[model samples]
Target: MARYGMQYGPPQRSRVPLVLVAVLGLVLIVILAVGGVLLYQRLDEPDSAPPATKPSTADAVEFRRVLKSEQGQCPSPPSDTVVCDANGFRYTVGRVELNGAHVTEVKAAQNEGDPTWHVMLNLNSEGAEAFTRLTTDLAKKQPPLNQIAIVVGDQVVAAPTVQSAIPGGKVQISSNYTKKTAEELARRITG
Candidate 1:
C-alpha cells in the first residue's frame, strides 16, 4: 500500500523515446518505398534506338532450310563470318550452290572512307548455265525482289546477276564495305 502517486498497473517506462524511434523507422521505410517506385518508373521509359539490331531468323521452316544449305558449307568458321586457309586464295560467296564462286587474290577496301571492296569470282560451264537459266526465269516472274545472294558459312555476303552468261567463269563484285570486311568476306568464301 505504498501509494506515492504510483498506479499499480503496467509500469509506463517513459513512452517518449520509444514513440520517437518508431516514428523515425516508419518515415525511413516510407522514403525508401517512394524512392524505389521512382526508380522503377525511370527504367520503364522508352528511348531512341537504331533499327538494324539483331539477325533475322525468319520462319522456322526457312531457318531449317537455310541451316541445311549452310551445313554443307561448313561451320568451322560459321556462316556469318569469314574463314581462310594457308594459301593466298580468297573465297567469295556464290549466287547459288555450286553455280558460281567469287575468287580473288586480294581484297582491299575502297580507299578514302569507303566501305566497299572489289571481288572476282569464277563459274564452270555447268554453273554458268544454271545461273543463266535461273536469271531468265526470275525475269519473267513477278516477284517482290530477286537477288543472287552469296552465302558465307550461314550468312549472305553478296548476290549479283549473270550479266551475260558468265561463260568464261569470270565475274566481279564491287561490295560497299570496309578493309577488315573485305578480308573477312574473302576468307569466309574461300576457306
Candidate 2:
C-alpha cells in the first residue's frame, strides 16, 4: 500500500493561456494606437472643397493711407486707425483711397527694369481720381506718411512709398514677388 502525498503551495497551472491573453492585449493596444494616429492625420488635412467665387466683405482689397507706422507689432486697442502688417513693419492705416469694387482688372506682370514679378490693378474712373489725389498728397509728406498701404482684409500686402503723384488708375505692387505669388495676389484682388 502506498501513502498519499499533499501539495504544499498552489496547484500546478499552465502559463500558455496567460501568455495568449497578454499577447492579445498587446495587439489590441497596438491597433488602438495606430488607429488613433491615423485618425489624427486625417483630421489635420485641409478641406478639399473649391474656393468660393466671390470673396467676403472682410476679405475685399483696399488701399489706405499710412497714418502711423513702426517696425514692430501694432499697438493694442489700435484706436481710430486700423493696423496692417507688411515687410516686417506695422502701419496704422486710415481712409480708404480705393476698394475692390473699383477694380476693373487684375494681372501679374514682370517689373520694367528688374527681374521681379508684380501685381497690376486697373481701376474705374472714380477710383483713378481718388488714387491720384491720395498719391499727390502723400508724395508731399515725409516717410511713413508717404506710404500707401495696399491691404487685403486686415493685412497689408504692400506699402509702397509715393515717389510722385501716380497718375491714371493703373497701380503695380512689387514686394520681391515670385510669378506664382504675383498671380495668386492678382486672383485674390480680382475676387
Candidate 3:
C-alpha cells in the first residue's frame, strides 16, 4: 500500500543570520571597551589649561623677613609691617630682603626621592649676598623670626624656617604643593 501522506525529516534552519548577529555584538563590545580606555587615558593626563588669573609681566616676588607670626587672624591696620597669611599662620613681614629683579631663573622641580614638588629660584650676585645675610641672622633667631615669608603679588607662598645660612643664590621653596601648583607658581614668578 502506498503512503497517503509523505513523511519528512526536521527542516534545517539557516544559522547565518544568528552567526552574524553574534559577531556584530562582539564587535560592538570591543569598540565600546576601546573607547572607554582612550577616554580614561585622555582624562588622566596632566592639566594644561590656562591659570585662573593671567600672570602679568610685573608680578612681584619678595622675600621678606617675618618679624612676628601668629596662628590667628591677621591684625587690621598693621603697624609699620605688612601682614601676610601662609599655611594658616599670619606673618608680620618686615623689609624686603630680596625681590623679583634679583631672580634670573625660575622653574618647578621634584625632589630626588620625594613625592612633593618645589619651585627653584636662581638669584643674581646681589641677591645671593643679601640672602646670605638674611639667612644668617634668621638662623640665629627663634620661632617666627627664624622664618622667611616668600610673598608673591601680596600672597605669601611659603614661610620656610631658616636652619642655617644658605650662601648660594639658589633658593628652593617647598610646601604642601602638588606638581600643578608648583608649575603654576613658577610661571607666575617668571612672568
Candidate 4:
C-alpha cells in the first residue's frame, strides 16, 4: 500500500508546470488589459461611438406597425366613376355623392371611449338628398345588401348598414376604422 508522501509506482508528476502555466495565463490577461487601455488612451476617439444603438424588438415592432398602418391620401377620380367593394357589389358615383364638388367637408373623429374611429362628411343639398334616399333604400334591404357603401377611387372604404334614413346633411361613416383609415377616408371624401 502507498504511504504518506510515497508514490505507488512511478514518481508523481510535479505541479510546478501547471502552476507556472496558470501564472502565465494571468500575466497574459494583464498584458492584454494594459495594452487595450494604452491603445484607448492613445486614440482620440469619442467617449462612445454613439453606442451603435439600434431599435429594440418592441420599438422595431411598433415602427413596422406604424408603417403598415399608414394610409395615403384619398384619390381624386373623375366626376362620373363606378367603384366596387371587395365583393362584387358596385357603388355608382351618384350613390356615393363624393363627386369632388358636393362634399363640403370631411373630418376624422374618434368616438369617446372607443378605439374605433370614423369619418364625418358634411354634404351639400344635392348630396344630402341622394345620400338620404340611398340610405332609406338600403335600410329596407337585408344584410350586406342593406349597407350603404362609401366608395372612393375603386375602394369601398366603408359599408355600414343603415337602420334608418340619415336625414341630416351630415353623415357619419363607421366601419371599425382605425385612426389612419378614418383619416384617409376623410381625405378622400374631401378631395
**What lDDT is reached at residue 154 by model 3?**
65
RMSD of each: 17.5, 13.3, 7.6, 18.7
Model 4, 1-191: lDDT tens per residue? 65787657788799999999999999999999999999988686532211112112211100000001112333345223344455544444333233445556657777667888876666678867876776677677676556554555456565666788877777777778788777766655444
The parts of candidate 3 lying over 4 Å away from their true place are 1-59, 74-80
Ranking by lDDT: 3, 2, 4, 1
lDDT winner among the candidates? 3
- Model 4 TM-score, 2 decimals: 0.47
Cα lDDT for residue 34, model 3?
100
Index of the highest-TM-score prediction: 3
Candidate 4 CA-lDDT value: 0.56
Look at candidate 2 and give me any clashing residue pairs: none
Poorest lDDT segment (10 consecutive residues) of candidate 4? 59-68
- Scored by Cα lDDT, where does model 3 land? 0.80
TM-score of each: 0.37, 0.63, 0.65, 0.47
Model 1 segments more than 4 A misplaced: 1-115, 159-168
lDDT of 3 by residue, 1-191 (tens): 88877768987689999999999999999999999999999998654333323223433688888888777665566533665555567778888778887877777777666778888888789989999999999999998889998988667888889999999998998886788898889877867
